[model samples]
Target: MTTEEKVARRKLSLLELAKDLQNVSKACKVMGYSRQQFYEIRRNYQTFGSEGLVDKLPGPRGPHPNRVSEEIETAILEHSLAFPTHGPVRVAQELALRGIQVSSTGVRGVWGRHDLLTRHERLLRLERAMREQKIELTEEQVRHLERFSPEFRERHIEVHHTGELVAVDTFFVGTLKGVGKVYLQSVIDCFSRYAWGRLYTSKLPITAVHVLNNDVLPFFEAHNAKVSTVLSDNGREFCGRKDQHPYELFLQLEEIEHRTTKVRRPQSNGFVERLHRTLLDEHFRIQGRTKWYEALEEMQQDLNDYLVTYNTKRPHQGRNMKGSTPYAVFKKGLPKATKKEPRKTAENTA
Candidate 1:
């Protein structure tokens, strides 16, 4: 097929899925095209028909096409080294501030040629160059190397029952007059998604341990179940390599395994992170009066009420527990316990 026809067919398929799903984000994710790219493709198809769908190759027609100068290229590399976290847009802005003329697209082209697609990738190359003495280092890059913590950084898993895995995360829930800055520590079973949370003034390891000790463990223990593993980020509160990391110690004492998300990969803990976002929208935002809370006790009470309704009443739309509340699913997964008393029988069988 001609390039135009091939491109047209692809665009038609994307448009059809977009129509079917009625969700730009989901459709774009499935088709591997960004939302902006999809919208542009749709617009071109609607306006110019199939002819507009043809992909255009880059570069000038003349022998002397526009090219980045050696000076400009050097500047780009130096800026990248200095601000390893900056992307093409920010780099272009920085260049403009330094009286250099370059479009974001041009900066991106330079980055692509260098294979510096992300800040993390740039940081790696910058470090290797410094080690090999390949490139001269700037003061800013040197300082950043000293300050950056690389450890600050998965999804397919089937959970058949509660207590197989639980995710715990701390969320900033704004400040209160008596409580100062408030934080919510949430623990959710990966299977049933039954959640428990407590508000606290500190994010210390003890606070997290408290949530597990007083809340999660007791509830599960009452049902004769035990938490197999807990998933969280590398935050010191969740876990660390230190010998005295209280959170890690607590998990060990409870015979629960601790698993952390990969560095820079929060989507690995998608379940808990999504819960935080939903709480931010529904509970925190709605109850926030003038962005300040009245009292800690009252706030905690409100949150507890919400949690009760969420666990016992609200039907979950999660993949496994469709049309079932979290509590309903949790009970089903509970290990069957034999009756304490044997059945009584009459002795007069004669």
Candidate 2:
């Protein structure tokens, strides 16, 4: 028998001996227990019978305290379903705001029991599927891909004019409204991290080119920035030739030099891709809206506010030693010839 069971049997024997001997001290000596302990066991056996000797009775009891109640668990399930991308930590904070005292670990345990850990896993599966569909390259083909990658170039350490190098990419927002998907076409100035984005219904090359022409180019022109080289991934939308493909006409019109990253290597365009993830985590997922496209106007407005804050107000790590925004960095690097003087100065002098 286990030690606990053996101890329980001995305690029962001691209780019987105490009753039979009619002397607590005599029973205590025989049982190797103190007089106080003998009397306690005798009281327990008298009050609760044989079961009392198996385990000590729970200490003086009142009503049982409730932990996370059923109502709170239901709320957690609802919140998680509505916002699948949010982790337990965020959910715990949200629950706290609703006056529920729950831990992130508690929420995670609940999620684990309910089979709700699918967001990241789904992304990994999708990435794996994409990789499987991709053709394996020979050493020569791999070398060719590397030659075309922007990472092949040594990043210029010197301060350069704005728009000398632009990073461009398309990233999908999480599945929206449980039906259609939304794509974000984004471009960031390599020097400033000043970014612009457009929401598209599709990730088609035609749609991408349209956003670049209509929205991105105008923003750059308005800021007096000109993109000399555009860096992007080898995704079919970005790298496919026009004559061989459906988007050939649109591609020819943009006329900018296009460079692709090594296939499946997102780190080559790490800055813009990192921004994509940050946008989803910090803004999209936290906002807790189920149907994102239905709130497209609001989403776009919030994104613009975020972009303006990122460019003009937020401190950028990519900014040089000056410790300024991307906008500030780009302004600081303006060519002296391009800098404009105040007009009407002589006329106003009189």
Candidate 3:
């Protein structure tokens, strides 16, 4: 960039930093600029755009009045472009060999005005000059260059209808009043927010498969719906590389696709996560501690009553299904996935 371009970039950067920090004093302190200068640059940029940053040299419009001749200045720029690896000192020495007699400081000043001081900056200019050429990049290089991006924002998925996707996950509900520590395996519809879960004493793969088979599948059958995909995290129960996982085998036999969230990416399974939080606040935290329930069967009965209230009576606050219950929204959904006749899933005691 030219000196004018550098000044404009500095001014623009300061303004952006100030807006982001939301404090002019702190922006100035970090950017190493005085408040007065910041205000001047901001005012000019607002009034006249980036062109205002150019130094309004008050003298002649042509080259330096008495300094290096036009011929010598042209020689300096040509030599610098021809040999970008050389710096100001080397350029001056090259000019001396030709009897041009220009100091290193003079050559540096010329280079600064033209913005050709750094080899990286010059190479960028050369690349711009060759913009019409086709450039192919390797896959690894493309992946490695992604660090230059600002940040990764979550992409929102559009919900066409209920049963298009189901997200399942296991949440660790605190120990019941009389029962030991337990878990709840929940499967929730992404569209209607309809949910179903079962209390389990163990967090095994079989527990997850039973939740899907007994609760989730029956619910889908009642509405004549098919789950296009079941999303989950990479827990041992819902995910594995081999076919030994009972949950994976169950999904396969049921003709439903199983998808796991990327490693370290829990947001991909956010629907089930939100459902877990809601249940924690409304169901488990409120009723489980009111009276000690020694038997897991008693807790299961209490959970079923709450699930009815949640699906049929509670008014959901979702934007898509306003003033409607989960059961109401679910009744209106149509199945999208292909349904196949049920078959027994393979069982192996490894």
On lDDT, the candidate that comes out on top is 1
Q: Which regions in candidate 3 have their CA more than 4 angstroms from the true location? A: 1-152, 336-350
What is the C-alpha local distance difference test score of each model?
Answer: 0.82, 0.71, 0.80
Give lDDT tens digits, candidate 1, residues 248-278.
Answer: 8777766678898777777778888878887
Better of 2 and 3 by TM-score: 3
lDDT of 3 by residue, 1-350 (tens): 88877867877889999999999999999988999998998898888887776667787788665567779889988787677778888989998999888988888777778787788876766767568668898988666564343343244546788888898988887776666888888888888888898998778999998888778877777666777788889898888755787777778877788877767777667777778878888988887668677888887888889889988999988657788998888877765546655534445323
Evaluate residue 270 in candidate 2 and report its C-alpha lDDT on the 0 to 100 scale.
76
lDDT of 3: 0.80
Which candidate order results from sorting by lDDT in descending order?
1, 3, 2
User: Largest TM-score belongs to which candidate?
Assistant: 3
Question: Where's the lowest-lDDT run of ten residues in candidate 3?
Answer: 146-155
Clashing pairs in 2: 242-248
In candidate 1 the C-alpha lDDT for residue 156 amounts to: 56
RMSD of each: 23.5, 23.9, 15.3
lDDT (Cα, 0-100) at 345 in candidate 2: 21
**lDDT assessment of candidate 2:** 0.71
